[model samples]
Target: MRDLPARLRELLLETGYTLDGVRERLGTVAATALAREETTPALRATRDGDPLGTLIRLWWLGAPVEAPDWLPVDPLVEAGLLAVQDGLVSAKVHLQPWETGGYVVSDRKVRPGDPALREDHVVGAGGASANLAQLVSRRPAGRVLDLGTGCGVQVLHLAERAREIVATDVNRRALRMARLSWALSGIDGVDARQGSLFEPVEGERFDLVVSNPPFVISPRGRFTYRESGFEADGFCHDLVRLAPRFLSQGGTCQLLANWLHVEGEDWRDRVGGWLAGTGCDGWVVQRDVQDPAEYAELWLRDAAEQGTPRYRELYDDWLGWFEAMKVTGIGFGWITLHDSGSLDPVVRVEELGQRVELPVGGYVDEVLASVGVAHRLSDEELLGARLVLAEGVVEERTGPPGAEDPSRIVLRQTRGLCRTARVGTVEAALAGVCDGDYPLGPLLAAIAELTDQDAVDLRVRAPEALRPLIAEGFFHISTA
Candidate 1:
């Protein structure tokens, strides 16, 4: 059979086919051909090579046709070594590092036969895959498991840092593609198994397990790439419930999943309950919440683009499914679990606007650090902890153009964590004067006299604003 790059070059040169056109044609071919290998050979041999050899060579070099090579050949790719992946497939390899010592890479979107001519039908590596990959914890681990290993993108990453790695997927086609990817990338020491979730490795344990599973909460298991067969968000819940069984002592599991936001229950608590009594510490961050209409439309558009018919009908079914279940919205997020049963686990619900490049490993470190600190400090101790104000603090007061009175006051810290605090004049003045040596009482008295306010009133109001700033790391109190 002709190399995929050659076939792609031939198609582009002879037929003036763009990548999208070729992908569409290939999708049609895949639907009817049954065996891609048998069909691809005939297509390649009969095709003319207009811009052929150059394109194929470019693909092999991992350099785009238009760009000059600046870096040495990626070690894994040059060796026939790591997985030769699609452009999108390579995106997944950049996701998470197991730790400072460990790295994860995978080829979740690769097909063996014709590398260059392969279609994007399988949903190999895309935004979701890349997002999850970026979010994987980079901490080193003894064992790592890549669940739902599509083309094994996560497995590749795990292989870098793990003493041992295991990857599992339900689709045999996906497994085949993953193997090809591994060979092309020159990565080894990965155990590729076939099964669903933890079934293939019932007795095995891992220091870290990472998955970008098929968490799309669809009514039917229509698409193998994105939808799980389990009903009513059961797949996500089961993963959360079952991850603990395979985790080693102090091990962690990081996953990206979608859950239904039902009408009656708090989504946060609902997800939190899934981890109860598993002897694990969990941190779940919900990033986005889409209502049923928006959810249905998004998935419907995705399906339609993938050539699924009856878009309108499918759209209705999705809404009906959500309505029947009383699901008002769908929550999308990341869930991280640690098997070491710490008393207080880090659970944060934050609104991360739109999409931003987040340093996943850095955030994971912060979470771990916060959890460690929480365990060491009692509630009372945390509350009573005196923190010195960070240095180089500045306050800016702004007023309307002709008004004598300032409309707003903003306080910003120049160093440390760099937080901003809004304040009243009294509070701002107090903060500016705080030198760690002065007692709160004397400062308030001095401020009261200067501003013509009652000392008692000054004392009462000043602490209210000052205490929060102090606790939040904006201001620190002196130990001396």
Candidate 2:
């Protein structure tokens, strides 16, 4: 395996075997088809004399092909990573270039009808992988931990700046695959372990922790990568509760999770209650919601268990489980917890239905940092702090047609969460005038004079008003 990295790198560089190179060789139509897991188009394009083309055709698309005598197949076969059975060199694992640089190696991409799919599947770059990677702070840290590190996708991102990376998974196969991916990416020094949750790091702590845990709310664990084999989102709930304990002071943990929305039960309270006694400041951003039927069907199709003659039986069983639990919907979101060491922890649970930009990690770090600052500051100190509107926050004014005094004024975010905040005339004016130049107290005093309102009253209420706006990324409190 060690020699394979260097050999692979040499061959790839010699052949220009990159994501862009493959796409260019295959063209748009075939590239798109290959992306959809259809090998026919890619097969037609890669039968040329190029070693890169042959490698892609045989390894990535999983299409059987005759190996040319020019390539070094013996080493890969001896390493147990490939097998040239039936005159066709087949990759034992899937290898594809990351959209960025480098490559990700994981279990072969399963087609819709592949009956040989294993139960303990280690997937790569699924939706939650992208979400968790984007939610986590990329800032340099002393050490980082990735729990449930399937394919070690998050470990690759954490390796950018983390001094040392530790990745743990219940599936040992995933840990092995994770190490393979690390080697494939031309990086090293990840402490990979086989264990569930924090078992491997019992007494250890870290500067950052990240996870895209097995959070699918499954009645049974039919698959290893998605289903946790836990009842009613227990995996997610427990991980959220347990992650904060292994963080150093002021350290942060981020994860992608799903929560059940039971009948007549508020989701915020259900998920929020999980953070009790954790002594960590927490924020939950709910991005998607699916009803019982929609949720069941999505995972069913995802596991490739749909459209079979037995589908009706499994479908009915899933619906029955949901009905028994009175689960109305499933909520999908990102969670960020910070060990700020505050006496009174701050917890914010919100749902942002609007589409946001990818990699909102910057906004998350900002929000958590601002929340810590808010907790540390006195009311007087908070009122005296200078603030400014965040970038991409624009003010919009609208009202009934022909009305001179606009009855509605909204602050809309063009990035991050893409949220809109409705503000009255006073708050709107305050947001407009804030330029990180004037402190909140003085600014409100100036507004007091213009509006004939009492300065003392404004000062008292201003801190409370700006508190949420700051935490929600509507405004920025200048620490400089």
Candidate 3:
């Protein structure tokens, strides 16, 4: 498999097979179907004998194809990427293309009619992988670590941004597959190590760390890629609790995780306990919450073992385990941390279920910077700073017909977190006119003068009113 990556790259280049090229040849519907792991539409579309078409059907659809003239298919056989049997060639591994113009290599999925995959089988870029990738921090760094780099999906992106990278995983097969993925993409020098959690990189710190860990909270699960083989939410808890030690100053760690939402307990404080003693500025944005049954069923389907007695047994075991643990629900989301050298570090927790734009990585940077800045300021100092409304922010007003002024005022942001804030008229006017031209003191003074309100009163209330807005990215402190 050493030269297989280069050989495959050469084959794809020779045949001009790219993400866009495949979509153009396969059409949108077939391409969409192929993305969902369905082969029928792609198989129907790729009936032609072209070299690229043959290769796509062979690798993506799990179908055998005759070798085309220009593809140089012998390298695939020599590299064990494909096997020739009964005069038809079939792929031994799946080479799925990502949005970054590179192919991610892994064991093929066990489709409905296909044989069951091994217990330790590594998956390609699945939904969770894509989610974490899209939300990965794009800010360049000196060194990066991809924790639990299954198939090296995040490592591919990190390699492009960092000077060096170390990709670690508990499963040796996952590390092997990651090496293959890096080679096939013509990416080199990624240090692939096999060890659980941070054991491989002990006593080492990195400028950036990214992971989509095996965070499924199940009762003694069997799979390696999704299940951590720990008690409920234990893996995620330990990961977060130990992450700050691995981050360099101002370095960021971004990962996806799940935490138990225990009955009669605030979920925020339950997760906040992980932040204790870490000293890093941590933020958890819970994107979704589900009851124990919904969470169990979702993972059961993900395992492709539904509607069977085995599935029922596993589901019941999960229910009994959660019940004994007093777990009523589960919260799933991204947890981001920035290493800060502060005696009193800050951690902000929020819930945002509404859809936001892709590449949510930039928001992590903003949140860390905002927390650092917002938490350090005194009220007088905050009042003296000049700020402006964030870009793409607009005010919307709604009320009954013929109303003089809309009863509700909403400030909607179309960038970053894409949050909408409801505010009173005073807050609305202040946020609307904060053009970076003046400090908050003068601005409130003028607003109070116009509204027949006491100038001293608004100034006294300004810090409490505006501090949250700035911290949440409703406005930005102007350096201009």
Candidate 4:
């Protein structure tokens, strides 16, 4: 095995084979043999100068190739360093870098163990990866579960942060590849198990659970790496339903998923209903929606580009499946669940028109900040909250000259959370006097005297304006 690399090097030079070309040849050689003999072709081709002998030698090794390596092998495979992985696999690594205890890095493309499958295109680290990474609460936990551990990217990332990490997948090939990638990458202490969802981890619980499941909604399971068995929306539903049992109190489950937009049902309520009585605080952000035709075409192109034939047939099948299920469209997004069951857990639905660049080491920070703020201010407590006007906030008033002293004054925030507040004269006067020194009562008194308004009445109304301004981020209060 040690001499394998040298022989492989020689074969490449003699054949004038590029890395990708060699990988393809190796995959084809491997597919004919047993799983145990998978890497024999590349090893023999390297050892012997005769390419035919090497090919025959691979047959003796018992490994066989079935697919091409759409994934690539570059710096990762060159140094026997990191494992070669797909885009989704790479995205998991990119998303949760902190879990690795150091920065996670990978080439955009790399080769798989099989050679016949030599040329694969990987999508870039996308929004789903970023969102899952961001939703990860950084607090250290005892055990982390990376469900559907494709290429073991999530497992590698989690190994850095969690005391123990377990990665589960249903594909034996993916599991094998993940193990090789793990070894190649030099990431230690990750247990790569093969099973669907939580099957292997039955009766096991974790402090944190993260997944970028095969949530693609398809008519049939075309590709094991990308599609799940639950049919349409079943993958996400099962994940959400099953997560509560595995999560520790106050722990979190963060995932990237695709859900169907069914006819006559709002997507938000559909997902929201999945969380009812789960005792989990849920945040689901729907990033994009594609109609049936568009969705079918997108995945069809994906299949065709991956060298899958029967493009029109596959496209028709996808449409027929969606039509049968009454699925109008596909909704792609992220969902995070915290075990802490606040009476009113954070549930927000917004459309991100386009992708936003994810901040490094900023995901956990944002989650913590939102949780802290949400816990601190619940319901009526917000009414009593006192805040100072933020710096760089300016009042802009626009109206015709002598136009009843202007209809309204617009208070715009220049930093923090971008927000704008329109204020009535009384509210405007109160905000103008807040210099971060006076308490709310004292400031309201002074404003009342200046404007000739009743102090008690001013105090009561003043808080209402402050509430919206503070909440909208037009003003921020000093912690002191």
Candidate 5:
């Protein structure tokens, strides 16, 4: 059993069963179909009795195939990774090739028209998992913690830069699968513990903490991987409030979470209150919102409960709970907290539904730094500080091309958040000349002289205008 993972890894890689190998063999069409949960195309593509095809049919498609001679059927079945019935072998778990050149083992996906999921079913790489992976800072760290690591997807990414890693989960089965994943990926030295969020790591601090927790706001805690057993977004709130205590100075914590939007309440403030006193700089980006009905249907389909006889019953229960709890809608997004160890922590919450760049860890690091600088610096200090337009930023003017004075001026970024800001003539002039060579005060004074405005008022209002740009990562505090 102990050597099973290494043996599987060697066999898998040798048989060309890696992520790139699988994709190449399946081709684009079959791979796309598989992503949609339609396996017929992939099955057709892998009809040949080759090693890679056999592996795909058995593990990737969850389809039983004949145990070939080269396969270690006895050892795999003995290790509980495979089952053999009348010589047709099938995987007991979904052995997926992750993008990080690793394998993630989880319970087979529950698709529509399939049986209901088990309570402790561990989930694989889904949208939320990928989102949190992209959102976490990849900077090298002394120690890292992956809280509520379902199948340990985050741990794979963290392993690249973290000297030590600790992964915790309430579901022991998940921890088991995570260990398998880490071992299969050749990632060792990870401390896997079984306990609910922060419980196993009490009195310890990590340089980075990341979670794609069971943040679904649900009426019943049926799924251990998706529900926290807490009432109405309280789990997410508690996670946020409790995060600061476990973060080392300058450490960061990030998670993908869902929050309730009750009637007559601002969702921003509702989520912002989670970070108000956490002693960390926080940033919340609400990427999407779904009303109660939509939210219920999404999760129902997620568990493959849509066509089941109890589908209506479960849906009604969820909707009834939402109504009783006054949850008009639900907002899903990313929450990031940076332990800046400051007396006045800066917390910013806003909606960002627009498309942006991926692997946003570096961008997020910049955002935290810029927001902290914008928050901590005084007006006079901001004026004296040197500034530069961030990379990929371009200025645009509208209102009949060739007109003497444009009706609108906009500064937009082509990267990171891809944020756009409308600016006045003074701001436009400042943007054109801010090359990090001069202080903002002198530039604003020059723009004031050119635009016939008071330098004092320009300097005061400029900081207010620049703060948003800085926070959005459109501007940088020049280090030059």
Candidate 6:
């Protein structure tokens, strides 16, 4: 078992089975079609008898083919990666080529026409996985924890920067496949453990922690990968509450989560309440909202049960549960907690539903830091602080193009969250000239002089108005 991963890696690299190689081989049409779970185009593309083609057929498409002479069939079968029947070979698990040179090992994806997924089925990298990877800060860490590390995708992302990584999962099958993935990816000494959530890592602290946990709000916990056995969104709430205990001071924890929007509650307060006593600066961004029916149908289709005989029964039951629980809607988003060790931790809960830039980890890091800075600074300190307009900020004036003074002035960001702020003439003037050269008090005083307004009143009102812009990454306050 130990030697097989090396041999398999050698074989895969020799056949050009990396992510770019496979995508190039499949071409644009077939590759795009395959992403939509339409297999016919990819099946036609991989009919050739070459090594890469044969690999795609057997492992990627999950199709059976005659054993090729060039490949070492015996070692693969011995590794339990493949099975042979009547002179044909087929993949027992999905060996997917992931980012750069990594491989993710998991159960074969259960497509629309495939058999129902097993209860312990381990899924490969999906949208949520990618989102968590993008959300995590890339700063080097002494130790990292990947909670619920199914197939170990986050481990691959953490390997380059972390000195040590401990991956935990409740499902033994997921831990087994994750070990294989780490071995095949050439990442050694990943401390893999089997336990639910923080149970496996109690009394241990880490510099960073990330989880794409079983956050699906479901009535039944049939699927270990997506559903927690806890009722409603309790699993997510519990995970949030327990995270700060395992985090070293100045460490960070980021995860993808779902929270219910009950009939009588504002989701912001409900989710914010999870951070009350954690002693960490927390940020929750609600990216999407789904009503009861849409949420149920989405997960139902996820298990390949959309067209099954029990489809209606499962669907009805899911909706019934939602209705009985008073769940008006479900909100899906990213929750980031930074263990800043502040005596008074700041927590912000807001919604950003528009499209934003990718690889937002740096943006997240900056936002959390800025939140702490903004929260700690007194009004006098804010006025004395030098500030600069952030990069990618563009100013626009609207409402009658030829008018002497535009009726509306907007400041928009081209990067990060792509947020916008509407400001009055004084704030607009401040934005145009804040280059971190002078303190905000002097700058606003100059703006007051130019706009013919009361300088003292301007100084008092400007700091509060600009606070949101600083939190949203539209401006940078110089701490130096």
Q: Compared with the true structure, what per-residue lDDT tens digits does model 5 show for residues 1-480?
A: 688889889999999998889989999999999889899999999999899999999887888998899888888888788999987998888898888889888888776776778899999887788888888987899989999988988988989899999999999999988988899999999999999878999999999999998999888799999999998999999999999999999999999899999988999999999999898999999999999999999988899888788989989999999988788899999999999888999999988888989888966888888889988889888899898988899999999867899999999988988888988887778778888999999999888888789988887899988887777777788987
Ranked candidates, highest lDDT first: 6, 5, 3, 2, 1, 4
TM-scores of the candidates in the order shown: 0.63, 0.94, 0.95, 0.64, 0.98, 0.98
CA shift at 275, candidate 5, in angstroms? 0.1
lDDT of 1: 0.62
- Which candidate should be chosen as best, given lDDT against the real structure? 6
Lowest summed lDDT window (length 10), candidate 6? 471-480
Candidate 4 per-residue lDDT over residues 156-186, each given as its tens digit: 5555678988888887756655664465345
Scored by TM-score, the top model is 6
Task: Pull out the clashing pairs in model 3.
Answer: none
1-480, model 6: which lDDT tens digit per residue? 568898888889899999998999999999999988998999999888889999999888899999999878888898788999999999999998997488999999889978989899999887898899999997999899999999999999999999999999999999999999988899999999999989999999999999999999988799999999898999999999999999998999999999999998999989999988899999999999999999999998889999999999999999999999899999999999999888999998989988889888866889898887877788898899899998999999998867899999999998888888898887778788888899988888888888898999988898788887777777898756
Per-model RMSD to reference: 10.6, 2.1, 2.0, 10.9, 1.3, 1.1
Comparing 3 and 5 on lDDT, the stronger one:
5
lDDT (tens digit, per residue) of candidate 3 on 1-480: 456577778877677677777888899898788667687888888888777788778777778887665555677788677888877788888887777777888887666545555788888887888889878778889889999999999977777789999999998988888888888777899988899999999999999899999999988868899999988898999999998889988888889999999988999998888876788888888999999999999887776767655778888999999999899899999998888777778888889998887788756677678776787788898889998888888889999999887899998988778888888777898877899999988888888988899988888887887778788788888888
lDDT of 2: 0.83
Ranking by TM-score: 6, 5, 3, 2, 4, 1
**Backbone clashes in model 6, listed as residue pairs:** none
Q: Go through the candidates in order and give each one's C-alpha lDDT.
A: 0.62, 0.83, 0.84, 0.60, 0.90, 0.91
Those runs of model 6 whose alpha carbons end farther than 4 Å from true positions after fitting are none
Shift in Å, residue 128, candidate 5: 1.7
TM-score of 3: 0.95
User: Deviation in angstroms for 221 in model 2?
Assistant: 1.3
